[model samples]
Target chain A: MNSLSLSIIGFGNVGRGVAEVLYTKMPHFKKKYGINIKVVSITDTSATIWDQEAINLREAIETKNHFGSLKFWGNEYEVYKLDPMEVVKEIDADVIIDVTNDKNASKWHLEALKRGKGVVTSNKPPVVFDYKELVDLANSKNLPYLFEATVMAGTPIINLLKEEILADSVKRISGVFNGTTTFILTSIETGMTFKEALKQAQTAGIAERDPSNDLKGIDAAYKATILHHLAFYPIDFKEVHIEGIENLSEEEIREAKKEGTPFRLVATVEEGKVEIKPKKVYENGPLAVSGTSNVAVIETDLLGELMLKGSGAGIKETASGVVGDIIRAAVSIYKYL
Target chain B: MNSLSLSIIGFGNVGRGVAEVLYTKMPHFKKKYGINIKVVSITDTSATIWDQEAINLREAIETKNHFGSLKFWGNEYEVYKLDPMEVVKEIDADVIIDVTNDKNASKWHLEALKRGKGVVTSNKPPVVFDYKELVDLANSKNLPYLFEATVMAGTPIINLLKEEILADSVKRISGVFNGTTTFILTSIETGMTFKEALKQAQTAGIAERDPSNDLKGIDAAYKATILHHLAFYPIDFKEVHIEGIENLSEEEIREAKKEGTPFRLVATVEEGKVEIKPKKVYENGPLAVSGTSNVAVIETDLLGELMLKGSGAGIKETASGVVGDIIRAAVSIYKYL
Candidate 1:
């Protein structure tokens, strides 16, 4: 059996969600790829647990969910009050999974890549801020740094760009890249104020408590920047011109609907320029994704227009992307091993 | 530098289209993957050309287009009067590219897989009829048998299934799998009879000379069978219940339109059962693709629902799928090497 060690740097919903999947699907993965994966360490913002022996993933998830830390998981673990990067270096793992939604995870990602650890991340900071540097490091080390969950959760956007559409040049990409904003906008379309819609989204667990990043279009801009790097060229997140839906009125949305259109938080990358803003879209067009659904329409030269739509955010969907990347990295490791 | 020798079977539109892409995108592929691919042999239905050295692909495409044979291009090639299976054994190549549109290539695909050659095909018969045998042969040999072009051309349907959605259990797959039938149906919606729409499709280069398979829903059934094998379990093509668009009248289409629905030849696979039939679809549903476009909506347990849409079939689109598979095979080969 080809066994690989894994360390997850977040005990949040997505982090625990991936742990849950890896625990349940471990046998399936092993049977499919001859890959036996064991989670050895988990680091959250507050505490880090390291066990050279395999951690009891079920206990870890349960403890984390109930007590907000893996330290209370009945004492088969060593808790370290250390930084995420320190825990990353200390853990002797083959792959590091970063589900931490923080800018500090960027440095840890680079550190993991530098230490020849394959990294699967759902966070977007590392990719948007240091795409060229981190990707170059991963390539230079022949390590996989996959963030399939960053853009559209597990909807297969990055894999589509990297694997399937290599023969065709993508000319334009436009879609609702942010599901929280999309949910908010759709709520506004039904006569809710922006504040009420955002509260509703938060209550529905679609929007984060601190959803300023989503409302200000920073999340979409970061996703667009990532897409730009993967599909077109390397570009900084700051370079992407952004316009948020924070200021849009219900009256404005109603007018668009009355005119037979709907306001969508459209992220467009055309001719190397990236923009994420609200725009009126045709009712039946590809970008008219409803609720919290994320959609991307890529106009390619040879294959014409391709659209991908799916659940953009949620614990299970994001965990699916992270686990997919882990398996992908493991398969690649299997090939090269 | 990693290099591989390629052999192409069936010098028809899709074969020639792949050749054109391979010729034009050589530098790009080489630069990206360090893969130097050369077409060493090409076989049409009537003739086969064996060149120990790399044949000039441009001249070969032109010769096949003008004179209907590669023999007219030069005398430096060896002409083989052998069957495709014999040629598969004779060829010293890494991969066999099958673009033939006949059941004869099914034997060739099995033979190539048995001979330890990676087979990348746009042909659907081998996959539909002898899917289990061919796939088992390829798997046991640890060789790739990629037929991404068989379904939705270069729209990345198979890659999405194989690589991206590994974590989710797919419950249902519904799609507009055939572009010719989609075009014909949409034309019928515009007040044309099925015969007139098929003629218009032929003139528009969307329908083939003998489109009985497409009209009788065999093509869509084949694609759905392929999808079933990829996404769900293995089932024979004959197991799919098929109902084609051959008998649909203008009045039926008009009635559907009046009922605020469109007639789409939907390929549906649910709970190990397959159905390909012309059915009424909601205007904005995933299967309600129009005008030579293909769409697939996969319902998964974890990822919720995912929809993929793109150009279903065309020379360039199918060629993109073929080349994508070639590159994918080469990358896998590179890792193993």
Candidate 2:
């Protein structure tokens, strides 16, 4: 069987979840595609670990979970305090899975693409910063650079466009793209103040310690930037107008609900523009998703309106997209390369 | 540049839509995939038209629209009363595009697969009756047999499961799978009897003249059978327990709406069983679609729940799925073969 090698950047929740999935689903993939996969390297913030004979994925997950870093990998394994880019230059793999939220992650993503490695990522900043450049490089290299988890993690919206909707032109895309904002806004609708809902979301690990990006609609704008680039044209993430949910009062939400519309932090891409702001959606509309669930309603030329709904948060859900992208890349590599 | 030839079986409304999409989107595919596709032949029930130089799609569409069938081909083209199976045996093409509702369409499908041609179709009976056998043959020959339009037209649900959910196990699928039933039931909710709503649907061309299959839930059962085979296991279409909306009155539908649940003809696949029946859905549920829309909610192990919604009818929409599948299979053939 042909063996596929993967190097993972970021051994955090989503990264660990990818490992867990690859561990469990390896057999299924091998049986299906006549290919086996190996994790050759894993890079965390502090250090990088490498095992050319294939890293022990379960042990790697356990080590990271117990000690918060890849530096704590077992003594027998070769773990070094190497920079992530250094690991990218040294380790050899067919694909690099970026699940980090680091600003500099795009550096390694570009470097890997330049080196002819397929890039599969759940990281948004890398895509938001370098979508066109990376896609160009990947096309030049004849490699697959898929970021299915970048927007609406694991929901396959990106794949939906790339694989299925190519025959039709997408005219507009409106979505509840941020989970943190959704949690806060929906909580406020149930009588919780914005601060109280923020605290609750932070307590539930749904929001970061500093949820400024989500609160300011920058996160949704980032996702919208990537999707807009894929669906229509490339625009700098800064070009998207941003309006956060930080100012949404419970009274305003209740008022909107009284009027039979609910306020959602919606990101809309239409007519070559990206807009992120709180918008009133009909109660029965496809964008009326509750809880932390994310939804996208894509209006197309021929198919009219098509809707996709699923969680855009959580480790496993994100990993599902990342791993699915990896398999997609692997399948292409197996077929063409 | 590569050239892909397609032989279309059954030049009905869907067939003409495929021709229209291909005619309009040829430049897009040629630019993107570096492949130009041509329809080598188009067959109706009465006759088949053959042209290796590519059938004039616009003329074919106009001719079929003006004339009752394809038998009235222009004097410039080669037309004869050739059986569809005979056309399948003689056509030199990379793929067979089946858009017929013919019960024995699977015969041509098997013949095409046996002849090493990839199969892409909007036809359901072929899949419902011969799913496992056809899939096994396609897998053994390394060909793609895709039927995305068989379920929700061009909604891409099948491609979602195949390309995105391979790493996870699907636990269940629940969908409002029939457009006729949805149109009739939702009409009844607006204060119409079953017969009245069905008559309105028939008048609107949403229901066939003999709407027994749709009124008996057999159409939804056929779709559930196909999805169940893809998600879990293979079962005969007859095995699905079907309950149509024919017995429901306007009072029952209005009472359910008053109680906050709306009646929907839902096809549910869970625990290796396919059930098609009218059931109560929460007003805000994903399956609670209005008009002739179709919605499917698929639950997987890692991704929690994912939903897809779109029009399950219309010539353009169904043609979108069929052409997308044809492109998919053509890409495979272009890449590996």
Candidate 3:
């Protein structure tokens, strides 16, 4: 059996985490599944390195750790300072993992798919913005273009909805799809102001420096859009009514709690429509139980209702999703061959 | 644009439920995805009916309500008393939905696949006993042999693990995979004796009269086997360490409760090994929060940990999963064509 050659397209937190998992589990994966996975290439904005014979994963990790760039790991490997697009095309790899923080790299994922390379992404934008086109492309090429880390990090929402929950039709999809925003909202509910909550989230590493997306519900909206697309049900995000926690006052949160309700930021898609907003959930509702832990309630005509709950973000959870996609892609290739 | 011609192989709870969902949601599915799905035939042990043209879904429901069989719906369709194997050959269906209680219909499903017909089943025996062969047949024929409604009703556990949660390698898969046994265990934890708990579960339709498969943990083991298979990771049931709630005492359940722990029947697969048993879970553990709901905790080397929770069984949930599979299959076909 031919070994699977992989290229890491980004050297961000998630990319590094994926590398760690692959390296740590390499021996076990090889022994159990009878497949050897080698990181043949690594590309960042600054540099690219290719070793078609297979780069030593540990050596590369150490090089990245000490020098913070592949430039110093100057082995006999082919190294180039090239653009991301060129690196993606030139890398002799069977799989390209797009862990770029740049949401636009999602488009590059499509390009990789077009070139007959399997794509596993943590980037959500291209999928949220152009799900149909990408899915169509992957299907046309008979390649797996997966985005398990796109929604709720390690939580299996995408797979859960598309494969397991093959719902007759989704009646309502609502839950805390964003962890940063949920943490901020929960902080505010505990009497902190919006800015104070944002600062607290930042301190806790939950919120990014630019918290616009999280606060405005754009992040959750993107996740919802991708989920709707994967469900093979069309939903227009523009028609999706959204109300972020930014506008909610302390009084409202208190009042809701007094009424035996909790305010939760929920992203919902139903009847070909999508909605992302803050809603007051009653005591018995799934959203009410979600709390700070990110959760999703997928209600379908057939399945009645199902909820997926977990840490929606963080190095471990996000890396886990990426690794799952990698293993899946590897197995798929093994089966195909 | 060709219409999907389907035949119901068993007019049981799941078969009827699939029909109801398809009938009710046909319009929306057509309007949204532009796919026309029509049931052309139906069969049970007593009789079989076929129509070259579309069968009136509403009329069929009405007839079944009045006469307790779609076979007596009158001269609008061709009705015959035939064996299941004969019906599998003569239905002229693009997909055969096998909802038969027969656990030995692996042959019938394989026969359908041999004839190049797709299969959507709620039957467990075929897949549980001979999944590799069934999958191979489906692959050889380029047809979908789906059983989304088999294990977790409509929760989509199989699809989720197979397609979405593709970890670099699944380190561990543990969960309350069986709803009936979980219900029984919950009852016992809530102060009922083992026999009384089993009786209550049966009364509530959560347990079968012959609940050995569930109580003995064989049902969960089967599901675990299926999960490991779909994930393309090798796991053997015999190699799995198995334990069940059958050996639990009321005092143990009470003592666990006092210590803020709950006893859950969990099936776990890790590092290519499998284990299915009843285990005590702390309050903060994922299983502790699972409650009466059927939940699976999938731990991967990459994706970290994720939990899926929902109505693990019921006609509606199971049918929903089947419908989801139908939609996915349609999308796949559309792309293929």
DockQ of each: 0.75, 0.72, 0.48
Chain A, model 2: TM = 0.97
Candidate 2 per-residue lDDT over residues A4-26, each given as its tens digit:
89989888889999999999888
For all candidates in order, the CA lDDT equals 0.86, 0.87, 0.76
TM-score of each: 0.95, 0.96, 0.79
> Candidate 3's error at A222, in angstroms?
3.8
TM-score of 1: 0.95
The numbered model that scores best in lDDT is 2
| Pairs in steric clash, model 2 | none
Give candidate 2 regions above 4 Å deviation: B249-251
Model 1 per-residue lDDT tens digits across residues A1-337: 7678898988889998999999998887887767888888888877777787888899888888899776675764577786788877887999999998888677888888888799999989888888898888998999999999998998889888887776787889888889888888888888888889888988998888999999899999999889999887798666789999978878998899778788888999986699988999998777888877998999987898898999888889999899989988888887666
Which order, best to worst by TM-score? Answer: 2, 1, 3
lDDT for A307 in candidate 3 is: 77
Q: List clashing residue pairs in candidate 1.
A: none
Docking class of 2: medium
Better of 1 and 2 by TM-score: 2
